[model samples]
Target: MAYRRTPAVQARLDAQREAVLQAAVVLLAERGYGGCSMAAVAERAGIATGSMYRHFSGKSELAVELFRTVVGREVAAVTEAARRESTPQRRLAAAVETFAARALRAPRLAYALLAEPADPVVDAERLVFRRAFRDLFAEQIADAVAAGEIPPQNAELTGAALVGAVGEALVGPLAAGGRHPDEVIPALVSFTLRALGGSHDSDA
Candidate 1:
């Protein structure tokens, strides 16, 4: 028979695992990915070094798990931000803002997950998460075209261009110390709107 996890027991275990991963991300970001150790992660997590092994087999496995969690959260934010808006333009702007804000808030994590291929597992998962974002953006662009908000053009090319632009443009400010995500959201929103032939007024 298959083992079953009770809700409360599952919740507790999930929380503990998340704490471990959270500690790992902070350490990985502070130290280079290669520099982080299982001991350091265990210490940061307030658990015995052996305890981390119970949750993850090794440092590389833990790192991959953390990468998946971080990318999942960021993508969820983008999806939520886009979900509430009615107009395609608003959805696009919200999606860009969500991506920028999250990346800025956790720039190191963003750089690790998006910019570097530290591990094969991370590389594979990151590609999937990124492609999901691209497809969602392209779909929004198509909707905007259908609504006559944007010109009918190369949807995939347009989506990829916009996503790349936002990712590259924000990397600097995001990685810069003492800058808040809110500080750059408006500019991002404005730039994306103009590029898509939509006005910033759509957000108003």
Candidate 2:
């Protein structure tokens, strides 16, 4: 006969799955992709190495899932910050600052997500999240252009450009364990504002 999972048993399994994912994230943040092996994750999760295969197919799948969960949360945070602002420039600035500030706060994880080399599966996820971030900026830029808050430009191109530029600028600091949030966020915000063709005197 085939076995079926009871509700209580399934809930416990779900919790264990979440625990495993969380352990992978912590390992990735501490040591990047290269250091986060299946054994390491299993050990960190307090599960036997072979037992990990019960929850995930292999390292690649676990890494990809970890990338999705963490990066998805980050993208949501910046998106929400931008959405809350009333103006295009303000929205852009909020997104930029929120992204930079949060990244600076978690330098190791930011570096892992933004710069570390990974398996093809995780790399694909990186591209998806990168585009997701760019799209958030693109939407705000399009709105700003329509409202004449900033000069008209190719919203798609500008949005992608901003994401690349800000991401590159943060790489060094994030790799070096980061600098003061106060210092990095304002600089990134000012740079993004200028790139968007807005005045420094205005709110970012």
**lDDT of candidate model 1 versus the reference:** 0.77
Top-lDDT structure, candidate number = 2
Q: How would you encode candidate 1's per-residue C-alpha lDDT over 1-204 as one tens digit per residue? A: 999999998898788888988887787677646655789888888989987877899877887777777667777889899999988888888898888877776666676666654767767776676687888789888989999988777777788888788777876774573186666788888888888777674453
Clashing pairs in 1: none
Give TM-scores for every candidate, taking all chains together and pairing residue i with residue i. 0.78, 0.94
TM-score of candidate 1 against the unseen true structure: 0.78
- Tens digits of per-residue lDDT for model 2, 1-204: 899999999998899899999998898788888878989998999989998898889988888889999988898899899889888889889999889888888898999899887778877988897899889999999998999888999999999999999999999889878887777788888888888888672554
The worst-scoring run of ten residues by lDDT in candidate 2 lies at 195-204
The most accurate candidate by TM-score is: 2
